[model samples]
Target: MIKDKPIFSVKNVCIDFKVGGKNILSKRSVLRALNDITFDLYKGETLAIVGESGCGKSTICRTAMRFHSPTQGEMTFEGKNIHKLKKDELKNYRQKAQMVFQDPFSSLNPLHSIYYHLERPMKLYHNFSKTERIEKMNEYLELVGLVPAKEQGEKYPHELSGGQRQRAYLARVLSVGADIVFADEPTSMLDVSIRLGILNMMNDLKHKLGKSFIYITHDIATARYVSDRIIVLYAGHMVEWGDVNKVIINPRHPYTKLLIAAAADPEREGKVELPIVRNQESEVTVWTPDSKGCPFRLRCPVAKSECAEEFVNAKQVSENQFIRCIHD
Candidate 1:
C-alpha cells in the first residue's frame, strides 16, 4: 500500500466562541471549543474522532472544512495554509472536501429534488454543459448506489428513507469530485442495523476510491470498525490517539478506558460493568494560562499531587501508541 501523505494538517488549532455574560467584573469571555487540537488526515484512511457531546469533534470538522475559523493555530491543506486562502482559492478547496452531516433529512433541501441538489454543485464549480451535468449527476447517483438514477433524482428529500437520504448526500459529494469526506456522526440518526451499511460504504469508498475520511462519533465500537486511527478527545483536549486496535485493546487514558468500559460487547450476552461518568463542567476549576498540568487530571482516578503541576506532553508508550496521561 502506498503511504499517502497528509492531505490536511491541523496544528495546535483552537476554536473559541464568545459567549455572552452578565457581571460588572466580567469582560467579554470566550468558550474554548477546541484547545490546541493537532491532527493530520492522511489520504485513503479514516481518522475517527471519538468523544462525548461537547468535546468539540464537530468543531474540528467545521474548522478543517473552513466553515468555522480557528481562533488560534494553523490549518494546512496540501501543505498550504487553509486559513489564509483567498475567496476563489477557498471555494476551490471546499470543492475537494465535503461534509456528510448527522441528520440526513435536515441536510437536504426539503423544497428541491435530489437531482437539483446534485446538479447545483456540479454547475457551480465545473463549467459543464447541461447535458454533461445531468450525465454526471446520474453517474454520482449510481456511484452512491442510488441506481435507477433517472427516477430517484426526481424525488424530494422527504420521499426517501434515512439511509436513502444519506446516500443522496454522499451522491452530492461524489458529484463534486470530493476526495476527503468529514462525516460527523453520519450514522447516528439511522436505524441501528443499517448504520453498518453506511460505514461499509465509507470503507468501500476509502479502499475502492482511495478517498480519505474523518469519522466523528461518540461510539467507540463504530470508531474501531470504521477508522484506521482513533483520536480520543475529552473536554476539548486529546487524551489518547493511535492505531485503532492498539487504543481499543489497550486504552491508556482514564477517559479512553471509561469509554471502552461503557461499550457493551455484542458477542457477550449479559451486560458488562458500566463506566463511571464525569461531570464535564466540574472537571476543572478554570483554564488558567499560569496553570500547567494534564487537562484530564481533575477527573482522573489515578491523579496524584504531582498531577497538579503542569502535565507532561504525550509520550509514546509503544510503537504507534501515544497517550497524554501522566499515569500512563
Candidate 2:
C-alpha cells in the first residue's frame, strides 16, 4: 500500500531556534530542534515519530505544517517546496495538511459551539451551502462515534467530555477535506479506556479513508499500534528507524533500547530485560549544535573511543533496520 512516489517528504531538514533576545544583556543562543531529519509519508500510511521528552517529536509536525521554516534542508508536499510557497499556495497547503493538537481543552474555541468549529472548515474549504454544511457536520460527528449527530453538534466544546472534544476535533479535520493529518499525541490526556477508543477510530480513518498520518508520541506501545513505520529520535538526532515492529522488538541503538526498557509491560509478569548503563564520561559532555561525533556518545554504554572522533553514519544492520551508532 506504500507504493509509488511519496505524497509528502522531508529531506535532510534541520531547524534551529534563537532563544533569549529580549534584552541587550541577554545574548541569543541557538538551540537546534531538528538535525538533518528526513522521512517520507506515503498515501494510506502512518509514520510514527517516537522518542523521550524533548527529543523533537512535536517539532517535526510543526516543520511539516510550515509553522517553522527549516534552517537547512527542505520540506515538500506533492513536490513543491513548502517553505517557498506564496500566500495563496500556502493557504491551500494548510487546507490539505491539518493538525490534531495534544491539548483537547484549548484546541477548540471556548466561545464557539462545536457546530461552529466543524462548520468553519467546511465553509472555508468546500464552499458548502448553509444546509449542506449542517448535514456534513452531522455526518462527520457520527463518523467519529458522536451519535445523534445533530444534537451533539450544537453543544459547546466545554460541554463535551475530554474524549468527545477530541472526536469533534477529528470531525473538524475530516470536514476540511485534509489529506494529511498530523496527530501530536492526541490521546495522551485521556483515560486509558478512552485512549483505546481514540486509537481504534484513528485506525479506521487511516485504512478506510486512506489518509496520511504522522503520529507523534513518546508512548512506544501506541507508536507500534498506530504506525506502519517508526523513526526514533534522540537529542534531535535520528538514532534509529525502520519497520515499527522490527525496531520495537529488536532495537539496535542504545538510546532506543533504553526507551523500550522503560516501557515494560506488566502483563509479562516474569519477563526481564537488562538495564542499559550510561558511560559516566558522557554525563559531563552535553550535546550541542557543535558536538563532535555521535550526539549520543556521551551516554551510550557501548560507545568506543573512536565514537567521539567523527560524525556517525547510519547503517542498515538488518533487512529493515537502519541505525546510527559506532559499534554494530
Candidate 3:
C-alpha cells in the first residue's frame, strides 16, 4: 500500500469549537474536539478510527470531509493543501472525497427520491445528458446491491430500510467518483445482524473500487474486520495506532486494551475483567490544551504523577505499532 505514496495526509490536525458558557469565566471558550491528529491514507486502504462512544470520531471525519476546518495543522489531498483550495478547486476536491454520514435516516433528503440523490452528484461532477445520468444512477443503485436498480432508485428515503438507506447514501458517494471516503460510523445505527452486510460492502468497495476509506467506529471487532490499520482514539487524542492485527492482538495503551476488552467475543470462556475506569465524561470537550499530561491518567490503572504533570507523545513499539503510555 505504501508503494504508491499516500493520496491523503492529515498533519497534526486540531479542531476546536467555541461553545457558549453559563458562567463569566467560561464565556466564549474553545472546546478541543480533535488534538494533533496525524495520519496518512494510502490508496485502496481502510484506516479505522476506533474509539469509545462520544470520543470525537465524527469530529475527525467532519474535519477530513471539510465540514470543519482545523484550528491548527493542514489536510493535504494528492499532496496539495485542501484548506487552501480555491472555490472551484474545493468543489473538485469535494467531488473526489465524499462522506457517508452516521445517521442514514437524516443524511438523505426526505422529500427526494433515491434516484434524485444519485443524479444530483453525477450532474455536478459529470457533464452527462439526462439519459446518461439516469443510466449511471441505476448502475450505482445496483452497484451497492440495491437490486432491481430502477425500482430501488425510484423509491424515497423513507421507503427503504435503514440498511438500504445507508447503501443509497454510499451509492451517492460513489456516483460522484469519490476516491476517498470518510464513513463516520456507517453501521452504528443499524441492527446487529444487518451491520455485517454494510461492513462487507465497505470491504468490497475498498478492494474492488480501489477506494481509500476512513472507517470510524466504537466497535473494535468491526474495525479489525474492515480496516487495514487502526487508530485508537480516547478523549479526542490518538492513544494507540498500528496494523489492525498487531493492535488487536497486543494492545499497549490502557485505553486501547479497555476498548478491545469491551468487544463481544463469543469464543472466549469465563467472565472477562474489563478496565475499572471511573469519573469518565461522555463529552470529552472539557479536556483542554493547557490541561497537562495524558487524558486517560484520571482513569488509567497504571498512571503515575508524571502522567498528570505533562503530556507524553506516542512511543513507537515496533515497525507497525505505537502507543501513548508512560510505560514501555
Q: Could you give candidate 2's per-residue lDDT for residues 303-328 as a string of tens digits?
A: 78887887577799888789988777
Which runs of model 3 end up more than 4 angstroms from their true locations?
22-26, 277-285
Tens digits of per-residue lDDT, candidate 1, 9-123, equal 8899878787666777778666777777888888899999998888889989888877889888999888889889889878878998899999998999999999999999888
Backbone atom clashes (below 3 Å) for every candidate: 3, 1, 0
For candidate 3, lDDT tens digit of each residue in 1-328? 5437899998998888888787877777677878889989999999999887767899887877778899999999989899889898899899989888889999999999998898888888899999989888888888789989999999999999999999999999989999999998899999999999999999888888898899998889999999999999888888999999999999888878877777889998999997665654522436766666788888787888998776688789988999888887
Instruction: Tell me the TM-score of model 2.
Output: 0.94
What residue pairs clash in candidate 2, if any at all?
282-298
Per-residue error (Å), model 3, residue 97 = 1.0
The deviation in Å at residue 45 for candidate 2 is 0.9
Candidate models: Cα lDDT each: 0.85, 0.87, 0.87
Give the runs in model 2 whose Cα sits over 4 Å from its true position.
Answer: 21-26, 270-287
TM-score of 1: 0.91
